[model samples]
Target: MASPLDRGGLPGHRVSVSPLDTAAAARHVATTEDGQRLSLAEQVAQVPTDPGCYLWKDASGEVIYVGKAKNLRARMKQYVQLTDDREKIPLMMQLVASFDYIVVDNEHEALVLERNLIGQYHPYFNVDYKDDKSYPYIAVTHGDVFPAIKYTREKHKPKTRYYGPYTDARAARETIDTIRKVTPICSATCAEWKRVRRLLDKRPDDAGIIGLICAQKGRPCFDYHVGRGPGVCAGMISPEEYAVNVRRVERFLSGHRSELTRELKEDMSEAAAELDFERAGRIKRRLDVVDGLDDRQQVVFPTSVDIDLIGFYREETIAGACVFAVREGRTVRTCEFIVDKGLDVAEDELVAGFVKRYYDETADIPAEVDVAVDLEDADVIGQWLSAKRGRKCTVHRPQRGEKRHLLETCERNARHALMRYMMRTGYADDRTNQALLQLESALALDGPPMRIECFDISTLHGRFTVASMVVFTDGRPDKSQYRRFKIRTELDEANDFASMSEVLGRRYAPERMADERFGSRPDLLVVDGGKPQLTAAMRQLEQLGLDIPVCGLAKADEEVFVPWDDTPVVLPSGSASLYLMKQVRDESHRFAITFHRELRDRAMTVSVLDEVEGVGPTRKRAIMRHFGSMKRLRAATVDEIAAVKGIPAAVAQAVYDTLRA
Candidate 1:
């Protein structure tokens, strides 16, 4: 369902694979600490920070688990920390005495390596999708030159254009039908056709040829086209037309949809214009047939044309970066980066760092590299990449339009990817329990809360009071389904009831909630505080004539506050519903804190640094550049940090001593 790099970042940027790459990582799998061997920590530290695929081999040198990571160090570290009883992982760990790897340049390369290795080795842990019969492909025969439609499970062999690994036989059949009507090709084997042609050419004083043409020409044949009428012969397509059609099939297989559509449209127009009403109707029908097949094409995005764009961000102790491959401004591939303590380096520098260190030795480089985020000197970096590529490489940030959307999508994917990476490495949790599940079970509802909405209000003397409503479906927090509301009741500090009431009144107002796509009338509603908060929410919904099930999650004992319930319903801590509630509660708390922090930090920032004349962008860059971070720069020395560019020696010295003092 997800790509191999969806597992994580590959070594640096070269997403290629080579043997001996795993040797270094294997040695790092276990390290000596305090006279005792601690395999995990040592393994994490020793993993090469290059792009590649890693194998987990048993004592017999058989690969058990294969994986890829953008940062081999972090990924290996994650595996090192797999202390839980994941059956396959633990088994693989015990069997894996060593490993092998092939380093490549980027996550996509890593993905290719992983898939190839899986196909080659058929590792035990990986999903082995059997049923060769189910994978129906459209194959063109090499010997025939004008190949017939054949269902197959084979890979794309040389000299033959294999169109699919189609999941459904009916779908494949429909495709074949569309192809037959659109192109001048026959489904019968060339041998059968040639034999029919020989008999016809000889004009062997027989009506067989006429019968065959009539049977097979306009109507279907024994392959379910004709229902035992005069048997049709498999000899309609002329040899030349068959050859031309075969080429068309190749174009169709190779992702030339627009070309196929254009040809179909032309044929339809010609048929109609020629006054061949019957033929014109047939052509128009064929055009409609092909139009419906557009979704089945391999290339989903219609406008993507380029290879990739890359971006990065650094925060506190973690650095995040994403390399988005664009095919016509649509992201077809992405590589995420997470580096620890990489604060001083800009994301563009990191991108440039990866490109230079990687593609410099590789043969593949995309035409243009777009940066969603900026670098200090983008043009210089672009020039560097261009020189290495031996082509005019242009790097630009999108101001607006589809490019921006591409960048945003890439960023969103990168965030999800980084989260996935962290989850894999045990740095974070991925499992989400639906908060509605807990509410329903605790309330003894008819079914799992299909739509459970939780409301939480945060305020400081009612100045920046805001309420957030989060939705959960099937016991999981669906953040995309969440909403935030700014309080506007003109109430004083700590007026939690009015804040709750106002938020509810706006959310359920018919005009707003009536949008079918956002048809989020909750099966259950939950407020974050005790009885008073729950009552306020319920009264507002009641006044609005919405009879939604309402409850309160008491912060004190984390008990459920329900309507007409005297005793609080306490769910088991380990129950699925409780787990869902915990997750939603935690998320809301996080969201609230994050919003509050932004507001707090805005006024709390130290303005003294801004007052300094020498603290321009260049000087600031130099300060952070040499010292590695703002924190370190603040603690730097006048002469000890004097090497920084743009900063006066006196200013550098003063900055260093001032922060130190």
Candidate 2:
């Protein structure tokens, strides 16, 4: 809420107007307090003609929208003159009580600052590119002495390598399993190595320690006995030898098949020359596996080719974007994104926004990027990318060639992805339209509720309480707008009414109303309970001075409760309106339960370890990493628990006693 002059180092100005007077003010005329009429052109003429970012705020001083422009004055003039023909502009202007701008040095600076401000404020009117599902990745813990290759959806760990954010999660998991089968790193072996390595680092010439460790021949895992793993646990494979296998797995996942195959063949030859027939046979098997994988990959270009292709397909306000990551002439990975374009932006602007956001998160930046649409600021974006990659990067729009054909293929894939999403959500169906109309008549509202938000509360024995807000637009669920809340109020028992009131109060608060993630105000509000919940919701809205329509749907009989009527309105069992209501309610319940369960699981994991006198987060993590899971930890003996790195014998005994108790 700081004044424009107080924000950053940029010189700017603020314009204020009354919300009630916005209709007349939309004509580009404003009446000052002294009764002087100032035309919008005159007002815009005073703004600096520099590239910058602008912010529009509602009456409560919350930022509702943020945008960047090459010329600040021209952009302001377009808004004032009502020449910006975006569908949402008129509605957004009506809510605009004031506006401000921050001038930047260049177009690229404007773009960067605009993105940062939008992320910080989450302005509602900005285009939000959100993925409904988290794609899976194959992660390798390269920081460890004996790296563990695993399938993961999250990439939070530092000093680790992640590859293939595959759209097909099952395929990613299968790949990880196959790699583990080819190059197995035993967990027991890793634990022992960590322990010995720590001791050796502190005492270099401890012969007694080395001799004692070397004297014990540890039992090998099942994979080692089955010939699928190197016998690291059985002392047959040294740490240096185990690291070679880890490097091979990393190379395989990184799409370096040619180099890895050559190296493996050389290793096999050396093993054969040394008369190690068993080792040579193992290397030969690995080489065949690598060759088989290489043959399966589809090659679209020469071996030296490395580039990324981006294509998009937009229908109405929703767009699906496809990214093809080509490495060493083959398609190594593919990524898909669903974008909600709140405004009717130009195709080139859409492409620019998508490129910036995508590359910002991705670690691998190709030297060349080909897009379906031609961008005006391609050079600026390329410069930004080059700085990020520490090398020269180029952005291009392929006209006619094999690259164009591949780009077209990527666009086709994007279209198919959009179609799949449409089919799954039943978006814009005739039945959905009929349902909206029916609901409007049944609820006695002004018009069909195009945007509906439903709330549900979930808790288990008064623990890990949570709430979910699910949004439905045009009778189709909009997962991007969905939000979860962890209830902060302390409660001795389950209280749905109080929980509903608290969630509604928090959601409708002035600050939350302007957040981009919350989206626009819902046409109607639905609560998952009976009359009491409906009353609670209505009361909260009334306290906040909000006039959104409120209703409650009871699960017992599917009865809908409205404030004016004492009797519950129950639509026909097979009616479309009833079905839509049930869908929204069920989705809210599912979302809330999922969030609650995640909290409960995480708390259980931490709480069990927290009860031990000497165990903290570090030692707890060590215990979990050593044993893999709580089930195995519980089954482990005291001596086994004490063997984990960083876990002292006294602390391990305390942890064992706590779990046993």
Candidate 3:
């Protein structure tokens, strides 16, 4: 018998309702761009009675939200009947022009597909975790003859084992350094290896060359002399010998400490029995390193216990989640995530969604998962995790005992994480409210500028000119509302004023003003320059017939220039008002420069490809699509370049040569 969690067993159908037949019920529905509409009743009637994922799209056909349901028709009825009490639901319904769904085998498949689609589309109404930093990982190349352990942020390569998405980059680097000391693995690209390579280059190539090199008996690197590296570069160790150390490092990192310690002890004993005191001493050192690492881990349970505890601290529409990964009775790792709860979602739903998303990216899965809140579908999530782990797994909420106590501790850490995030982003604090008030008094505004917009222009000479608009709501960045513009006006030289004016005109145009995505007009407008930029912005607003307050922030003197005054208002050095201004200004500048660099680099890549013979626009595009960037293209060999469609071997050679040059 097939388990309920089985996926992709049979093809399911897609259900969509046409809008033409539902004209009588159109009052309850939003219309599409092509005069098409579907009433909530018609939508609910057409949905099939099956488990699946549904996508709610806006009139512009953009997916605004994605959800899963055990019964599609029943779920549709709930939305149509306006039963969900989430504050954003009513607004979402107003914007939802249409919805469609894909039937699946069961709720397990629905859950999997929903998480995938959410990750793919990043629907606005979904709970998306937004963190700018990419955690570092300890990566070991699996296919290399003598594998090397490395610290990397990216994990896209095939046949590579990645151990972590460590929250602390310094800790990841330290782990790699420690592994190098204990494993004696050779880093082929290190300075010591390169020095050895230079010596090999001066000698004639022969079958016995490595043996002859090793016969010299001189240490090729400091690490070799210090016993931190196998003398692979000096040809003192074979690949087979080096692999033993590599496996030891892998076992140590994989949390198989007991087995690794046992194996090390056996090796040490064998070495001593053979009268090899030196090798036995080396093995003893490795055992000490392994034991030292184990000693640092906090013991949370008996040796048989292995579990993961997830705790959350939510405030309004945002939440901070912390994970404590326990293995072999000790807490091995901790990770933190920040979730943007766009709607009023329940804590149980939040926990389930987070577990599914978090486990999807991680390689390790424990036998049990303890969450801060009880889940409605704990069994379903456990089934999914069990399938993922190829073993039985359980998801539960602890009621009492050490697990509950530890869970409370995890929640406290989660609270700290949230507090740190609030402090870092200047969100939801008395200080932030005071900063807004300070700005209001300093700028002599009628009220606090609750919605502040800052504009900045970036360019290299006269090339790839761009403008950015950054929004701050309630004294914190509202990144979703941020906008970027490419300066359409051609200029012989960089013109900050002209760029600023063009961007302002485009942003406040009548058509854009009516669009809901732009939201309400900003309470304050700030340009990233002095009087000239401010005057240019003011002129644009006057032409548009708008009376919003405008100001300029000059970077040179850190002075704030208002349209009503000639002398700049110098905000107090340590004032929150000045700090807020700097934050907004710096963010806008960074956003503009990032966009500008994207365009500039794209142009540079095309121009560089143009230098190669027989490489036309089509071929250049194919090459760019294949490699994604100029750095990757330059790293490609001639044969790899030839693999791109529409390019011949000769042209590939030419392109490769040009890129290298």
lDDT of 2 by residue, 441-514 (tens): 99999899999999999998678999999999989999999999988888899988888889999999999999
Model 1: worst 10 consecutive residues (lDDT sum): 223-232
Q: What clash pairs does model 2 have?
A: 122-516
| Model 2: CA > 4 A from native | 1-91, 97-123, 130-132, 142-147, 155-158, 181-251, 430-661
Candidate 2: residue 498 Cα off by (Å)? 65
Compose the digit string of candidate 1's lDDT tens values, residues 324-424: 65443333334455543223333444454444433332223457766665654456556655654577777678778666666666667656655665566
TM-score winner: 3
Number of clashes in every candidate structure?
A: 41, 1, 0
- Please rank every candidate by lDDT, starting with the best: 3, 2, 1
TM-score of 1: 0.37
Q: Candidate 3: deviation at residue 6, Å?
A: 19
What is candidate 3's lDDT per residue for 1-661, written digit by digit as tens?
1212233333443433333224543433445456565465665676688888777888887889888889988887777778976555666788877766767778987887787777767887777675755667787777654567777877336667777667778888888777776667766456755555455556535324554565474456677777777876667776667778888877667665787788889989999999999999998998788788887888888655779999988865578888898878888788777877612467776777788877766557789999867787888889888987789999989999989999999889988988898889866676578889999998999899999999999998878999999999989899999999999999999988888889989999999999989878898989999999889999999999999998999999789999888999987654568778888999999999999999998888878888898988888889889998778888899999999988899999898788777
lDDT of all predictions? 0.58, 0.77, 0.79
